[model samples]
Target: MPPRSPAEDRAAADSDTAAAGREQTRQRVIEAAIGLLEREGRDAVTTRAVAVAAGVQAPAIYRLFGDKNGLLEAVAEYGFAAFLAAKHVDPDPQDPVEDLKAGWDLAVEFGLANPALYTLMYSEPGNATSAAFTAGMEILMGRIRRLAAGGWLRVDEQLAATLIHATARGAVLTWLSLPEDERNPALLTALRTAMVTAVTNQQPAVRDAGPAGAARALRAALPEQTTLSSAEQQLLREWLDRLAADG
Candidate 1:
């Protein structure tokens, strides 16, 4: 590559500084909006209010986020990023089922702790496409894959992921809907256990459980196998996926 001239280097440095400043402003605005949402509910998160809280002009919000809706989208993404940061991932847990349970509990705990942020992040279906949300899902899928690799998964990986996510969301929403005096910790425990039972087998399904367990285990481990060619692995994966889904 050709070396940049001094003028070009100065221009690039200026661009970098400008980009960093913009990101800092965005973070400030997002944090301010989140504070308003948590303290005064969604209606208080207006562009004017956020700008005031962020110590910026109202037009700065428009320049940074386009509009209130766009600002909300950014807030939801920030919430997901916060949730993802709190998550503890165990790549090789001694007990995959326990790991799954812990993961679900952590998600529910986060929702319970940040009811306003959680509701805002989850209430809109479009936020599911956020990068942070996608990253969190990837973590959940990794846990599910671990269960499958251990022959502990009762359902297909995709279905298992859905069940786990749905249960956590339902638990959080249901808990938040109840009066504080009426709220019960048992409800969370019951939902968590039910989700676990719904998605996992008590024993390794690969042995006497069924062929589906074996298929799932094989499918989960397929990518790590060195013996298969790329084409062979692809074909095997298709077959295993079909078998795993059969249950």
Candidate 2:
């Protein structure tokens, strides 16, 4: 390929700058929409209201987000991104099971803290397909994979993920629906424990050994396996370290 001329180089640089500016503006608008949703309710997140809050014209909202529904989707994505940021997944947690509990608690606490945002992100099934939501699912899947590799999983990976999500979602929404006087802390604990029992095997898959021991064996033999790719082996190794520490 021929080297770019000065004019072409300048054009490329200008294009990058413009793209960055657009992304910044998009973030500002999403933030404005989130603020409105949290403070004044979802109905208050009108195009006019968001435009005023973001200091942009209504047409800019349309130009950037396409329509009101699109703006709402962006708001949902922002909520997912925020939740993902708060989550601290330990690549090598000492106890994978305990780590799973902690992760579950964090998600529930986030929903309780941000009910409006949580509702917006999860009330409809469509939001599950958003980029941010998919990213969060990937993190959950990693955790599930760790459980499977450690011989702690009772169900298949996909079923375990579904059960975890369902339990958490049910717990949060049910707790929120109850009257203040009827709300009980045990509800959350019960749901979490139930989820653990439903998805995880109390005894490790290997006889005469527990999860930690099983994890070590798997870690040692992981290199001999050909099913998983190189990147997967590296990640599984980290999880194995955590499980071995538990032993």
Regions of candidate 1 where Cα sits further than 4 Å from its true position: 1-11
lDDT of 2 by residue, 125-234 (tens): 89999887898888888787777666777665667799999898889889888999999999999999999998877866656577665775586467568999999989
Q: What is the lDDT of residue 245 in candidate 1?
A: 76
Candidate 1 has its poorest 10 consecutive residues by lDDT at 202-211
Maximum-lDDT candidate: 1
Tell me which residue pairs clash in candidate 1: none
Tens digit of per-residue lDDT, candidate 1, span 1-247: 9999999999999999999999999999999999999999999999999999999999999999999999999999999999999999888999999898899999999999999999999999999999999999999999998898989999988889999999999999999999999899999999999998999998999887588999999898887889989999999988988887777
Each prediction's TM-score versus the true structure: 0.94, 0.80
Which portions of model 2 show Cα errors greater than 4 Å?
1-6, 208-224, 227-247
Error of 1 at 142 (Å): 0.7
